[model samples]
Target: MSSAGHLYLHTPFCGSRCGYCAFTVEVGVLDRRDAYTDALLAELAVEGERMGTLRTIYVGGGTPSLMGPERIARLLDALRPRCADDVEISMEANPETVDERSLAAYREAGITRVSLGVQSFQAGMLRVLDRQAGPEQAVAAVDAARGAGFESISVDLMFGVPGQTDELLDADLARALEMGVDHISWYELEIKPRTALERAGAALPDEDWAADAYERIVGSLEGAGYRWYETANFARPGHECRHSLGYWSADDYVGLGVGAVSTVNGRRWRNHAGVDAYIGTLSSGVPPTRSVEHLDEPTRRRERWMLALRRDEPMDMRWAGPPDHPEALERLVEGGLIDVDADHIALTRRGRFVQNAILRQLMEYA
Candidate 1:
């Protein structure tokens, strides 16, 4: 749309907030959903009027499935005009909220993909993470999506939680693969401040144990025929998420609704996190953008490299900066961490295990 073809809509309501979640989401606010959607529509209209046709639309949040069909329809109606015919329309849902009716409504509203947050398949693991859904719901959700004509579906799984072992995580992976979804995203649980997990003082897997589990999971997934396309994402050939790809590739996007962030025309901005403040701003005939960052070339380039290196594809060696940094690159390669060939630097299996550290080193050297 406009100069960019990506849009993100933030729906910040959930039945219950996950303990480890740091997203700016509100729980127990379904009563005010109608008003919230109205404000969101206003925000979308402003962005759509400025942006013409989008290539991707990602409706992500606390739990988008909790929104009724009418709410989803109204949001899509505002977005339809701003999207190209081949736009990849995707939404994120928690496993517990998905049902036949919701799945049917999503397809009717032009959703080409669905990403279910099925964090873990074990009932005990789910309880430890404060997730509402268990293994049965995760399996049923995937089945329902496929039955409802969704060609592309993805399941999100997390590892390295307290009391979780590599063997237990391996079982979760096997169950997910057996569910026949098109994609998988496996993430390790991170303890952030202000979360229930932190407040309860839950014990986490040791760093070395976490690393071992990650390595085992990666090798297991690859062995099971899933492609590790990005740091936390795997897919069956063509099922990689287009919306997320746009982000990792540093493509432009516009975010709507409260607490949503967007990068467009080389500038990044975030909507106001407060609902009343966001609604008030829109009532004043303007967007509720609370902060904006106009990224310079070096800043953009640095971000581009950082994001690109997350994929299996290598960063263009020409974009890697100085030749003298051979020491840094060589060290990473010799450690079985990365592969450097011709004009590209790609991650080896081990590199993805410590991707965050490697990227930090590259940024420092650059």
Candidate 2:
């Protein structure tokens, strides 16, 4: 039993398969949502009791919006008593599923933030990505969530798809800004192993193109008063997702439901990703966990460094490397890639582009 204040719950249900997604998700499983929620509550009763108290919770998913209002409310009812008074609760929803009624229900259930998955606003891009949502639904969903009393709203966008273009992405950013969303997740579309997109073999953009797209997005968002708070997250002032920040800060958190992962006191464990196997394990009176790891001090330190360097804030003094790092911090500072202060070290706008190479060089002296 540990007192981690952050929690993550995974719901592995989706209405249809998105071609580029490779997360452990089961499509067209609406009929089994009740049983799935029951298993989750059971896991909570057992594990949540050991989790001390919670300050933030993120309901991530194969699209949690698929669970609908009643089930979402029931899940929240179980979590309400255990949460701190000002806990930040975020739920992930898809644009197609984000109706007014559903948004209102989620707000009533204590969801303060709703992250809409609007992969691309272009019809051709959506078709290539195999998403059912259109551009209009994306706008309507954002408006509906704001109208439903959600204090914070974020939208997800993707780049490097087949039909993605500078003009298309620029328009998407403009639309997100026009809608007054407080947060934006602008990321490149990675073609991972075994994904439908990967299998189909349609050529996506090259690395250089993706890099250019990233720069354009950063410029557009920054011009609109959005800060690049993390590697792939941007937000207006006071709208940064605290739950997401917790991950970069390495705060202890407990994860629930099939395929969820948890970290408590430097120990890591992931639940079984298979739905039946997860439910069956719990039914047999054992935890549904499938794997575990104990992070040693060096690994933990390196992880802290990596995560910190990828964030928007300054690196804590404790996490900073030796007096002089291998990468020649002074040289990088001169080159305008990074900055160091008595209290913190942070990446500059230029450093964000080559973060991996810079981090590797710095870690050699860590």
Candidate 3:
């Protein structure tokens, strides 16, 4: 089998957990930074054998920027030799955790792209989300990433937030547009189970209102010359996030660090989610503990269809395999929900708005 070309390194350190976050994260582990980096390197040494020339490397969080440039540089230095010449290296940073000098250092260390976690621009909304960074800090972080000479700078925003009104969302959009960032990941806030938001019974905006907000977000970004390349992602013509595209395109990828998940050669595994366990096992010269699953052909095929439909492009039917309900395709087309060509099928603009519902009628999910 061909080696995987995408890599995702998870850094689980966070100063404090967010109200909406449920990611594998370790808070108050500042002292474990060095050990964590060591663990990641050790894991990479083993996993790297399965990786091909890396096309994309994504350093995601609990706030990867909190690891500081030195740790990141060491990780990249080790990864550089295995990377393609034009590999895209991206890292996610919380605005409160980055600055101009640190961002420059991160750039010098080999990160080509930086995605700032600017969840919202309103102070009340930031508080509701329990974000540490203020509006100005998010702006400064973007400016810093730009000044640091990053090839691309992206920001994350949220809609459907508990207190997010259209005016507030418009303001946030205006701020993002004003900054002229290269990309934006505007996601709806979901009150996931066990999250602080869910526990506190925080309610989201009405579904109809959220739908309108999503439309507005898509329209504003597209109007500003950005492409709605994916469901929740907008970018300038060539600044689309290649790392994320790799995932949507169903490319094999290797993931490193505690709680990181990898799928390669039909086998998927997730490393155990304890930092101590990860570090100790790697230090003992053994692979970290993990839960492994072998994906079946039907599972993979269904996933390919689901992921491909999320993009604003045609899904090659030959590659994706037949849908569970081929008859539904004709019905969907009649309803203007999808466009089907001889060998490919794609969602219409209206269909994209209810992608999940379409997927449900077209396929089965456990």
Candidate 4:
């Protein structure tokens, strides 16, 4: 047993798929919720032994809130005994899928944190992304989460969407700050292959404009007393997402449910993505089919550097192993792209904006 302390659970049901989403998800599957919950618990019974004293558990999804509080409570009750005393259990939610009553039930069910998917507070942007929630619903969700007394409440926002204007971005930012949530994940929009946005030939803002937008987002959030803790994540002091920090720090984790991926003791695997297959196999007392990959030392080393550099903290080179191009350090340092002291190296403020380019120069792949 690897005794991995981090865990992730995926719930794949969604009312509808977003235009820019490429995640494994099933729409119009509300009737299968009970079966799916049973499958998750069945799978966890076998996988639970692989975990030891979990420090964090993130329930992510197509819309985890759609699972309803009763199902969530059942799942958490099963996992509770395995969790550490101060474990952080987080879940992702869609704004329109939650209400004050439901959020209160979720909190009572042992979910300490809630991350609402409020991609944009602008109605036009929401329509462009095919999000069912409007700006008012987003606000209502946040308010409801707060009223529910969750330990931390976060929202997911986006930049670089088509037809986004400076005023629109400002309005979104203003609304987010006004909400006073504990954390925010503001990401640039990407047109993933096979997604509705990509199929429709949706284009993102130009690189220069996108870059400027990112800078503005960072500045605005930081100005509002939020720490730009990670490249795309901002948080108040002591509110950083522990589950995500586990991954960036190269810790092993177990993932459950259909389409979930896990890494433990240098081996990684992804469960098959079919909902019916997952449920059927688990119900039959068999683990779902999965594809496994064994990670090499060099591969893990490169991953360490890639994930660590995304944070504002220093990376311990000794733990990360040598970069492919160690000789590039002096040049990067002299160019003010990074700062190095003995075995610890960190990206400078200027370098973080062009982090991808810096990674390309330091590692085999960016």
**Ranking according to lDDT, highest score first:** 4, 3, 2, 1
lDDT by residue for model 3 (252-273), tens: 9999998999999899999989
TM-score of each: 0.93, 0.95, 0.99, 0.99
Worst 10-residue lDDT window for candidate 3 reads: 142-151
Q: Please provide, for model 1 over 1-366, each residue's C-alpha lDDT reduced to its tens digit, 9 standing for 90 to 100.
A: 336778888888888888899998888778768888888888876766546578998989978888877898888987787689899999998878888778988889888899999999899899998899988998899989988889999989998889997778878978877887889999989999999999999899998988888877778778878898998889989898988898888887888888998887777888768767777778766878678899887677778777888888877867645333357887888788888887888888777778878877666434
Measured with C-alpha atoms, the lDDT of residue 361 in candidate 3 is: 98
Choose the strongest candidate by lDDT: 4
Q: How many pairs of residues collide in model 1?
A: 4
What are the per-residue Cα lDDT tens digits for candidate 2 across 76-159?
Answer: 898888889989999999988888888998899889999999987788898999998998998899989988988899999998
Candidate 2 wrong stretches, greater than 4 Å: 320-327, 364-366
Error of 1 at 134 (Å): 2.2
Question: In model 1, how large is the Cα lDDT of residue 279?
Answer: 74
Per-prediction count of colliding residue pairs? Answer: 4, 0, 0, 0
Candidate 3 ranges beyond 4 A from true positions = none
User: Which 10 consecutive positions of candidate 4 have the poorest summed lDDT?
Assistant: 203-212
